[model samples]
Target chain A: MPYPEELVSPMRAELTRLGVKELRTAAEVDGFANGQKGTALLVINSVCGCAAGGARPGVAMALEHGTKPDAVVTVFAGQDLDAVAKARALFAEYPPSSPSLALFKDGKVVHFVPRHQIEGRAPAMIANDLKAAFDKHCAKAS
Target chain B: MGTFHHDTHELHGITCVVETRGPRTWVGRVHEVGPAGVLLHDADVFDEVPGGPTKAEFLARTAAVGPWPRHKSVVVPAAEVTSVRRLGDLSA
Candidate 1:
Protein backbone atom coordinates (compact mmCIF):
# COMPACT_ATOMS: atom_id res chain seq x y z
CA MET A 1 0.00 0.00 0.00
CA PRO A 2 1.21 3.49 -0.75
CA TYR A 3 1.55 5.93 2.12
CA PRO A 4 -1.29 8.32 2.80
CA GLU A 5 -0.72 11.70 1.15
CA GLU A 6 -0.70 13.36 4.54
CA LEU A 7 1.90 10.92 5.72
CA VAL A 8 3.97 11.26 2.56
CA SER A 9 4.23 15.05 2.64
CA PRO A 10 6.09 15.18 5.91
CA MET A 11 8.42 12.43 4.83
CA ARG A 12 9.03 14.04 1.48
CA ALA A 13 9.63 17.33 3.25
CA GLU A 14 12.31 15.76 5.36
CA LEU A 15 14.30 14.67 2.30
CA THR A 16 13.72 17.95 0.53
CA ARG A 17 14.85 19.84 3.60
CA LEU A 18 18.01 17.77 3.62
CA GLY A 19 18.71 18.78 -0.01
CA VAL A 20 17.76 15.55 -1.70
CA LYS A 21 16.10 16.05 -5.07
CA GLU A 22 13.07 13.90 -5.77
CA LEU A 23 13.13 11.98 -9.08
CA ARG A 24 9.47 11.06 -9.39
CA THR A 25 9.64 9.70 -12.91
CA ALA A 26 11.97 7.85 -15.24
CA ALA A 27 12.28 10.93 -17.44
CA GLU A 28 13.32 12.97 -14.43
CA VAL A 29 16.00 10.46 -13.61
CA ASP A 30 17.15 10.54 -17.23
CA GLY A 31 17.15 14.33 -17.29
CA PHE A 32 19.23 14.39 -14.16
CA ALA A 33 21.74 12.01 -15.65
CA ASN A 34 21.87 13.65 -19.07
CA GLY A 35 21.31 17.28 -18.18
CA GLN A 36 23.49 17.52 -15.15
CA LYS A 37 27.03 18.35 -16.26
CA GLY A 38 28.98 16.87 -13.40
CA THR A 39 29.00 14.37 -10.59
CA ALA A 40 25.58 13.40 -9.27
CA LEU A 41 24.58 11.33 -6.30
CA LEU A 42 21.61 9.00 -6.62
CA VAL A 43 19.98 7.52 -3.54
CA ILE A 44 17.36 4.79 -3.58
CA ASN A 45 15.15 5.72 -0.64
CA SER A 46 13.37 3.07 1.40
CA VAL A 47 11.11 2.82 4.43
CA CYS A 48 13.00 0.72 6.87
CA GLY A 49 14.10 1.20 10.47
CA CYS A 50 17.74 1.20 9.42
CA ALA A 51 17.01 3.70 6.63
CA ALA A 52 15.23 6.02 9.05
CA GLY A 53 17.77 5.42 11.78
CA GLY A 54 20.83 5.55 9.62
CA ALA A 55 20.86 5.96 5.81
CA ARG A 56 19.09 9.27 5.19
CA PRO A 57 20.57 11.01 8.19
CA GLY A 58 23.95 9.61 7.33
CA VAL A 59 23.74 10.95 3.77
CA ALA A 60 22.63 14.33 5.08
CA MET A 61 25.56 14.53 7.46
CA ALA A 62 27.98 13.37 4.82
CA LEU A 63 26.87 16.15 2.46
CA GLU A 64 27.82 18.66 5.11
CA HIS A 65 31.47 18.24 4.21
CA GLY A 66 33.40 20.58 1.91
CA THR A 67 33.65 18.09 -0.93
CA LYS A 68 30.39 16.51 -2.08
CA PRO A 69 28.59 15.68 -5.28
CA ASP A 70 27.56 18.63 -7.39
CA ALA A 71 23.97 17.40 -7.08
CA VAL A 72 22.21 14.98 -4.73
CA VAL A 73 19.03 13.23 -5.78
CA THR A 74 16.78 10.41 -4.53
CA VAL A 75 14.02 8.05 -5.67
CA PHE A 76 11.60 6.31 -3.36
CA ALA A 77 12.23 2.58 -3.79
CA GLY A 78 8.68 1.30 -4.14
CA GLN A 79 7.10 4.56 -5.24
CA ASP A 80 9.13 5.49 -8.27
CA LEU A 81 9.57 2.17 -9.94
CA ASP A 82 10.48 3.29 -13.46
CA ALA A 83 12.78 6.00 -12.23
CA VAL A 84 14.52 3.52 -9.98
CA ALA A 85 14.85 1.04 -12.80
CA LYS A 86 16.34 3.66 -15.10
CA ALA A 87 18.87 4.68 -12.50
CA ARG A 88 19.86 1.08 -11.91
CA ALA A 89 20.56 0.69 -15.60
CA LEU A 90 23.27 3.29 -15.19
CA PHE A 91 24.88 1.08 -12.60
CA ALA A 92 25.91 -1.68 -14.93
CA GLU A 93 28.52 -3.26 -12.70
CA TYR A 94 26.61 -3.53 -9.47
CA PRO A 95 23.47 -5.47 -8.65
CA PRO A 96 20.19 -3.75 -7.69
CA SER A 97 19.95 -2.46 -4.12
CA SER A 98 17.23 -0.52 -2.43
CA PRO A 99 17.99 2.02 0.19
CA SER A 100 21.32 2.18 -1.58
CA LEU A 101 23.53 5.07 -2.66
CA ALA A 102 25.30 5.46 -6.00
CA LEU A 103 27.70 8.21 -6.98
CA PHE A 104 28.23 9.01 -10.63
CA LYS A 105 30.99 11.07 -12.17
CA ASP A 106 30.34 12.38 -15.67
CA GLY A 107 27.46 9.95 -16.14
CA LYS A 108 29.42 6.95 -14.97
CA VAL A 109 29.10 5.20 -11.62
CA VAL A 110 32.13 5.81 -9.46
CA HIS A 111 30.89 4.71 -6.08
CA PHE A 112 28.15 2.42 -4.82
CA VAL A 113 26.78 1.88 -1.29
CA PRO A 114 25.12 -1.49 -1.23
CA ARG A 115 22.54 -2.79 1.29
CA HIS A 116 25.18 -4.51 3.39
CA GLN A 117 26.55 -1.11 4.29
CA ILE A 118 23.21 0.25 5.54
CA GLU A 119 22.03 -2.42 7.97
CA GLY A 120 22.65 -2.13 11.72
CA ARG A 121 24.61 1.08 12.02
CA ALA A 122 24.37 4.52 13.61
CA PRO A 123 23.49 7.45 11.35
CA ALA A 124 26.73 9.06 12.37
CA MET A 125 28.65 5.97 11.35
CA ILE A 126 26.97 5.92 7.95
CA ALA A 127 27.61 9.64 7.62
CA ASN A 128 31.28 9.16 8.34
CA ASP A 129 31.50 6.45 5.75
CA LEU A 130 29.76 8.62 3.17
CA LYS A 131 32.03 11.50 4.09
CA ALA A 132 34.98 9.32 3.37
CA ALA A 133 33.57 8.44 0.00
CA PHE A 134 32.79 12.08 -0.71
CA ASP A 135 36.26 13.13 0.23
CA LYS A 136 37.66 10.67 -2.24
CA HIS A 137 35.27 11.28 -5.14
CA CYS A 138 33.46 14.64 -4.81
CA ALA A 139 35.40 17.47 -6.30
CA LYS A 140 36.53 20.31 -4.02
CA ALA A 141 35.54 23.01 -6.50
CA SER A 142 32.18 24.46 -5.43
CA MET B 1 17.39 -15.82 0.66
CA GLY B 2 17.77 -12.49 -1.15
CA THR B 3 19.33 -9.45 0.49
CA PHE B 4 18.00 -5.87 0.20
CA HIS B 5 19.09 -2.62 1.86
CA HIS B 6 17.33 0.62 2.80
CA ASP B 7 18.76 3.80 4.25
CA THR B 8 17.20 4.51 7.63
CA HIS B 9 16.05 8.06 6.98
CA GLU B 10 14.81 7.74 3.39
CA LEU B 11 12.40 5.01 4.42
CA HIS B 12 9.28 6.81 3.27
CA GLY B 13 10.23 7.31 -0.38
CA ILE B 14 11.42 3.93 -1.55
CA THR B 15 9.38 2.22 -4.23
CA CYS B 16 9.79 -0.98 -6.25
CA VAL B 17 8.07 -3.12 -8.84
CA VAL B 18 7.35 -6.25 -6.84
CA GLU B 19 6.54 -9.67 -8.33
CA THR B 20 4.38 -12.07 -6.39
CA ARG B 21 4.17 -15.88 -6.12
CA GLY B 22 2.14 -16.45 -9.24
CA PRO B 23 2.33 -14.20 -12.33
CA ARG B 24 1.40 -10.96 -10.66
CA THR B 25 3.19 -7.63 -10.73
CA TRP B 26 2.58 -4.03 -9.66
CA VAL B 27 4.46 -0.79 -9.16
CA GLY B 28 4.19 0.99 -5.86
CA ARG B 29 6.30 3.08 -3.57
CA VAL B 30 7.26 1.56 -0.26
CA HIS B 31 5.64 2.94 2.84
CA GLU B 32 7.83 0.68 4.94
CA VAL B 33 10.37 -1.73 3.43
CA GLY B 34 11.21 -3.92 6.37
CA PRO B 35 12.15 -7.50 7.00
CA ALA B 36 8.65 -8.63 7.87
CA GLY B 37 6.80 -7.42 4.78
CA VAL B 38 7.18 -4.48 2.49
CA LEU B 39 4.42 -1.96 3.14
CA LEU B 40 3.73 -0.69 -0.39
CA HIS B 41 2.00 2.52 -1.36
CA ASP B 42 -0.26 1.28 -4.15
CA ALA B 43 -0.61 3.74 -7.01
CA ASP B 44 -4.33 4.14 -7.46
CA VAL B 45 -4.95 6.33 -10.51
CA PHE B 46 -8.73 6.46 -10.33
CA ASP B 47 -9.16 7.55 -6.73
CA GLU B 48 -10.36 11.08 -5.98
CA VAL B 49 -7.44 11.38 -3.61
CA PRO B 50 -4.68 9.92 -5.70
CA GLY B 51 -2.33 9.97 -2.80
CA GLY B 52 -4.62 9.27 0.11
CA PRO B 53 -5.10 6.84 2.96
CA THR B 54 -6.58 4.42 0.46
CA LYS B 55 -3.07 3.92 -0.85
CA ALA B 56 -1.85 2.78 2.55
CA GLU B 57 -4.98 0.78 3.16
CA PHE B 58 -4.53 -1.03 -0.11
CA LEU B 59 -0.93 -1.81 0.71
CA ALA B 60 -1.88 -3.18 4.09
CA ARG B 61 -4.46 -5.43 2.45
CA THR B 62 -2.58 -6.66 -0.61
CA ALA B 63 -1.63 -10.30 -0.33
CA ALA B 64 -0.24 -10.91 -3.80
CA VAL B 65 2.75 -8.67 -3.10
CA GLY B 66 4.58 -10.52 -0.39
CA PRO B 67 6.19 -13.49 1.26
CA TRP B 68 4.12 -12.52 4.32
CA PRO B 69 5.92 -10.35 6.85
CA ARG B 70 9.68 -9.86 6.76
CA HIS B 71 11.97 -10.42 9.75
CA LYS B 72 14.70 -7.71 9.97
CA SER B 73 15.06 -5.22 7.15
CA VAL B 74 17.95 -6.18 4.94
CA VAL B 75 19.03 -5.91 1.29
CA VAL B 76 16.21 -6.71 -1.16
CA PRO B 77 16.72 -10.03 -2.74
CA ALA B 78 18.45 -9.51 -6.09
CA ALA B 79 15.82 -11.67 -7.77
CA GLU B 80 12.96 -9.46 -6.60
CA VAL B 81 14.24 -6.35 -8.38
CA THR B 82 14.43 -6.04 -12.15
CA SER B 83 16.02 -2.60 -11.70
CA VAL B 84 16.47 0.36 -9.31
CA ARG B 85 16.46 4.15 -9.83
CA ARG B 86 16.21 7.49 -7.98
CA LEU B 87 12.88 9.34 -7.97
CA GLY B 88 14.70 12.68 -7.48
CA ASP B 89 17.01 14.35 -5.06
CA LEU B 90 15.74 17.02 -2.72
CA SER B 91 17.61 20.29 -3.19
CA ALA B 92 19.98 21.28 -0.47
Candidate 2:
Protein backbone atom coordinates (compact mmCIF):
# COMPACT_ATOMS: atom_id res chain seq x y z
CA MET A 1 0.00 0.00 0.00
CA PRO A 2 1.11 3.54 -0.68
CA TYR A 3 2.00 5.84 2.18
CA PRO A 4 -0.31 8.53 3.47
CA GLU A 5 -0.14 11.62 1.25
CA GLU A 6 0.22 13.79 4.35
CA LEU A 7 3.24 11.77 5.44
CA VAL A 8 4.99 12.04 2.07
CA SER A 9 4.08 15.60 1.13
CA PRO A 10 7.04 17.09 2.98
CA MET A 11 9.33 14.48 1.47
CA ARG A 12 8.04 15.37 -1.98
CA ALA A 13 8.57 19.02 -1.19
CA GLU A 14 12.26 18.47 -0.57
CA LEU A 15 12.83 17.92 -4.30
CA THR A 16 9.98 20.04 -5.59
CA ARG A 17 11.44 23.05 -3.78
CA LEU A 18 14.54 22.64 -5.97
CA GLY A 19 12.40 22.81 -9.11
CA VAL A 20 12.45 19.07 -9.71
CA LYS A 21 9.28 18.19 -11.59
CA GLU A 22 7.21 15.60 -9.82
CA LEU A 23 5.84 12.87 -12.07
CA ARG A 24 3.00 11.48 -10.01
CA THR A 25 1.25 9.46 -12.69
CA ALA A 26 2.30 6.97 -15.36
CA ALA A 27 1.17 9.38 -18.06
CA GLU A 28 3.47 12.07 -16.73
CA VAL A 29 6.36 9.64 -16.60
CA ASP A 30 5.66 8.62 -20.22
CA GLY A 31 5.44 12.24 -21.31
CA PHE A 32 8.83 13.04 -19.85
CA ALA A 33 10.56 9.86 -20.99
CA ASN A 34 9.15 9.90 -24.48
CA GLY A 35 9.03 13.63 -25.18
CA GLN A 36 12.08 15.15 -23.52
CA LYS A 37 14.66 16.20 -26.12
CA GLY A 38 17.76 17.16 -24.22
CA THR A 39 19.64 15.89 -21.18
CA ALA A 40 17.37 15.04 -18.25
CA LEU A 41 17.87 13.59 -14.80
CA LEU A 42 15.29 11.19 -13.38
CA VAL A 43 15.32 10.44 -9.66
CA ILE A 44 13.48 7.51 -8.09
CA ASN A 45 12.95 8.99 -4.68
CA SER A 46 12.23 6.81 -1.66
CA VAL A 47 11.58 7.25 2.06
CA CYS A 48 14.79 5.54 3.11
CA GLY A 49 17.26 7.47 5.26
CA CYS A 50 19.85 7.31 2.48
CA ALA A 51 17.46 9.30 0.39
CA ALA A 52 16.89 11.87 3.15
CA GLY A 53 20.53 12.02 4.20
CA GLY A 54 22.22 11.97 0.80
CA ALA A 55 20.27 11.43 -2.42
CA ARG A 56 18.03 14.49 -2.21
CA PRO A 57 20.71 16.73 -0.72
CA GLY A 58 23.18 15.49 -3.31
CA VAL A 59 20.86 16.42 -6.14
CA ALA A 60 20.36 19.79 -4.52
CA MET A 61 24.12 20.36 -4.47
CA ALA A 62 24.69 19.04 -7.99
CA LEU A 63 22.16 21.48 -9.39
CA GLU A 64 24.64 24.23 -8.48
CA HIS A 65 27.18 22.81 -10.92
CA GLY A 66 28.01 24.93 -13.96
CA THR A 67 27.12 22.05 -16.23
CA LYS A 68 23.83 20.43 -15.37
CA PRO A 69 21.01 18.56 -17.03
CA ASP A 70 18.43 20.60 -18.94
CA ALA A 71 15.65 19.03 -16.88
CA VAL A 72 15.34 17.48 -13.42
CA VAL A 73 12.47 15.16 -12.54
CA THR A 74 11.50 12.83 -9.72
CA VAL A 75 9.00 10.07 -8.89
CA PHE A 76 8.39 8.96 -5.34
CA ALA A 77 8.81 5.20 -5.04
CA GLY A 78 6.18 3.99 -2.60
CA GLN A 79 3.84 6.94 -3.05
CA ASP A 80 3.88 7.35 -6.82
CA LEU A 81 3.80 3.67 -7.69
CA ASP A 82 2.67 3.99 -11.27
CA ALA A 83 5.06 6.80 -12.05
CA VAL A 84 7.96 5.01 -10.42
CA ALA A 85 7.22 1.80 -12.32
CA LYS A 86 7.04 3.62 -15.62
CA ALA A 87 10.24 5.50 -14.95
CA ARG A 88 12.09 2.32 -13.99
CA ALA A 89 11.06 0.72 -17.26
CA LEU A 90 13.22 3.28 -19.02
CA PHE A 91 16.26 1.87 -17.29
CA ALA A 92 15.43 -1.79 -17.32
CA GLU A 93 19.06 -2.82 -17.34
CA TYR A 94 19.46 -2.16 -13.64
CA PRO A 95 17.67 -3.82 -10.77
CA PRO A 96 14.85 -1.92 -9.11
CA SER A 97 16.26 0.08 -6.22
CA SER A 98 14.78 3.14 -4.58
CA PRO A 99 16.63 6.43 -4.18
CA SER A 100 18.32 5.73 -7.52
CA LEU A 101 19.31 8.42 -10.02
CA ALA A 102 19.60 8.23 -13.78
CA LEU A 103 20.93 10.65 -16.34
CA PHE A 104 19.19 10.49 -19.69
CA LYS A 105 20.32 12.19 -22.88
CA ASP A 106 17.97 12.26 -25.81
CA GLY A 107 15.80 9.58 -24.19
CA LYS A 108 18.58 7.14 -23.35
CA VAL A 109 19.98 6.58 -19.89
CA VAL A 110 23.73 7.26 -19.90
CA HIS A 111 24.46 7.14 -16.19
CA PHE A 112 22.82 5.35 -13.30
CA VAL A 113 23.46 5.46 -9.53
CA PRO A 114 21.82 2.57 -7.75
CA ARG A 115 20.72 2.62 -4.11
CA HIS A 116 23.79 0.68 -3.03
CA GLN A 117 25.92 3.63 -4.10
CA ILE A 118 23.75 6.07 -2.20
CA GLU A 119 23.75 4.16 1.08
CA GLY A 120 26.53 5.02 3.54
CA ARG A 121 27.74 7.84 1.28
CA ALA A 122 27.65 11.51 2.24
CA PRO A 123 25.71 14.11 0.27
CA ALA A 124 28.86 15.86 -0.95
CA MET A 125 30.27 12.60 -2.25
CA ILE A 126 27.04 11.77 -4.00
CA ALA A 127 26.98 15.31 -5.43
CA ASN A 128 30.47 14.84 -6.78
CA ASP A 129 29.37 11.66 -8.49
CA LEU A 130 26.40 13.42 -10.09
CA LYS A 131 28.56 16.39 -11.02
CA ALA A 132 30.95 14.10 -12.83
CA ALA A 133 28.05 12.52 -14.71
CA PHE A 134 26.68 15.94 -15.61
CA ASP A 135 30.09 16.99 -16.91
CA LYS A 136 30.34 13.87 -19.04
CA HIS A 137 26.79 13.78 -20.42
CA CYS A 138 25.34 17.28 -20.08
CA ALA A 139 28.29 19.45 -21.02
CA LYS A 140 27.80 21.46 -24.21
CA ALA A 141 30.35 22.01 -26.96
CA SER A 142 32.11 25.38 -26.76
CA MET B 1 18.53 -37.25 6.21
CA GLY B 2 16.94 -34.46 8.23
CA THR B 3 16.35 -31.03 6.70
CA PHE B 4 16.94 -27.96 8.87
CA HIS B 5 14.85 -24.93 8.02
CA HIS B 6 15.95 -21.47 9.01
CA ASP B 7 13.38 -18.76 8.73
CA THR B 8 12.76 -15.23 9.97
CA HIS B 9 9.09 -16.18 10.27
CA GLU B 10 9.39 -16.09 14.05
CA LEU B 11 10.42 -12.45 13.76
CA HIS B 12 7.58 -11.55 11.43
CA GLY B 13 5.14 -9.00 12.83
CA ILE B 14 7.73 -8.09 15.46
CA THR B 15 9.61 -4.78 15.52
CA CYS B 16 13.30 -5.43 14.97
CA VAL B 17 16.66 -3.75 14.87
CA VAL B 18 18.47 -5.02 11.79
CA GLU B 19 22.15 -4.50 11.02
CA THR B 20 23.61 -4.80 7.56
CA ARG B 21 27.10 -5.90 6.66
CA GLY B 22 27.81 -2.38 5.55
CA PRO B 23 27.12 0.85 7.44
CA ARG B 24 23.34 0.71 7.16
CA THR B 25 21.04 -0.32 10.01
CA TRP B 26 17.26 -0.56 10.15
CA VAL B 27 14.60 -0.47 12.85
CA GLY B 28 11.09 -1.52 11.97
CA ARG B 29 8.45 -4.25 12.05
CA VAL B 30 9.15 -7.31 9.97
CA HIS B 31 6.58 -7.74 7.27
CA GLU B 32 7.99 -10.58 5.16
CA VAL B 33 10.78 -13.13 5.18
CA GLY B 34 11.78 -14.59 1.87
CA PRO B 35 14.84 -16.26 0.41
CA ALA B 36 15.92 -12.91 -0.95
CA GLY B 37 15.74 -11.00 2.32
CA VAL B 38 13.55 -9.56 5.05
CA LEU B 39 11.08 -6.83 4.31
CA LEU B 40 10.54 -4.16 6.93
CA HIS B 41 7.52 -1.93 7.20
CA ASP B 42 7.61 1.60 8.58
CA ALA B 43 11.37 1.28 8.78
CA ASP B 44 13.93 3.80 9.89
CA VAL B 45 17.20 3.05 8.13
CA PHE B 46 20.36 4.75 9.38
CA ASP B 47 23.95 4.81 8.20
CA GLU B 48 26.56 4.80 10.94
CA VAL B 49 29.48 6.84 9.73
CA PRO B 50 32.30 8.83 11.23
CA GLY B 51 31.01 11.23 13.89
CA GLY B 52 27.60 9.64 13.72
CA PRO B 53 25.74 7.62 16.33
CA THR B 54 27.03 4.12 16.93
CA LYS B 55 24.64 1.19 16.59
CA ALA B 56 24.27 0.88 20.34
CA GLU B 57 23.71 4.58 20.81
CA PHE B 58 21.15 4.66 18.03
CA LEU B 59 19.36 1.68 19.50
CA ALA B 60 19.47 3.29 22.94
CA ARG B 61 17.94 6.46 21.59
CA THR B 62 15.31 4.43 19.77
CA ALA B 63 14.56 2.57 22.97
CA ALA B 64 14.27 5.84 24.84
CA VAL B 65 12.25 7.62 22.25
CA GLY B 66 10.65 5.38 19.63
CA PRO B 67 10.94 4.06 16.10
CA TRP B 68 11.13 6.83 13.53
CA PRO B 69 9.09 5.61 10.60
CA ARG B 70 10.91 6.82 7.52
CA HIS B 71 10.56 4.01 5.01
CA LYS B 72 7.11 2.76 4.27
CA SER B 73 8.70 -0.55 3.36
CA VAL B 74 12.19 -1.75 2.40
CA VAL B 75 13.79 -5.10 1.65
CA VAL B 76 17.20 -5.66 3.16
CA PRO B 77 18.91 -8.30 1.03
CA ALA B 78 19.99 -11.48 2.82
CA ALA B 79 23.50 -11.04 1.44
CA GLU B 80 23.80 -7.67 3.18
CA VAL B 81 22.19 -8.44 6.51
CA THR B 82 24.34 -9.28 9.51
CA SER B 83 21.91 -9.48 12.41
CA VAL B 84 18.29 -8.97 13.41
CA ARG B 85 17.09 -8.52 16.99
CA ARG B 86 13.78 -7.53 18.47
CA LEU B 87 13.76 -3.83 19.27
CA GLY B 88 12.00 -4.58 22.55
CA ASP B 89 15.03 -6.58 23.65
CA LEU B 90 17.32 -3.57 23.56
CA SER B 91 18.09 -2.15 27.02
CA ALA B 92 17.33 1.51 27.50
TM-score of every candidate: 0.59, 0.62
lDDT of 2 by residue, B1-92 (tens): 01122563866655678888898999877777788888998788778889988878887766543466688899999999898887655631
Model 2 native-contact share: 0.00
lDDT of 1 by residue, B1-92 (tens): 11245554354544444544433343445555554454455332112254555533443333222212222233434355443322221100
For candidate 1, the docking band is incorrect
RMSD of 1: 14.3
Cα miss at A17, model 1 (Å)?
0.8
**Model 2 quality (TM-score):** 0.62
Q: What pairs collide in candidate 2?
A: none
Error of 1 at B77 (Å): 18
Share of native interface contacts recovered by each model = 0.00, 0.00
Off by over 4 Å in 1: B1-92
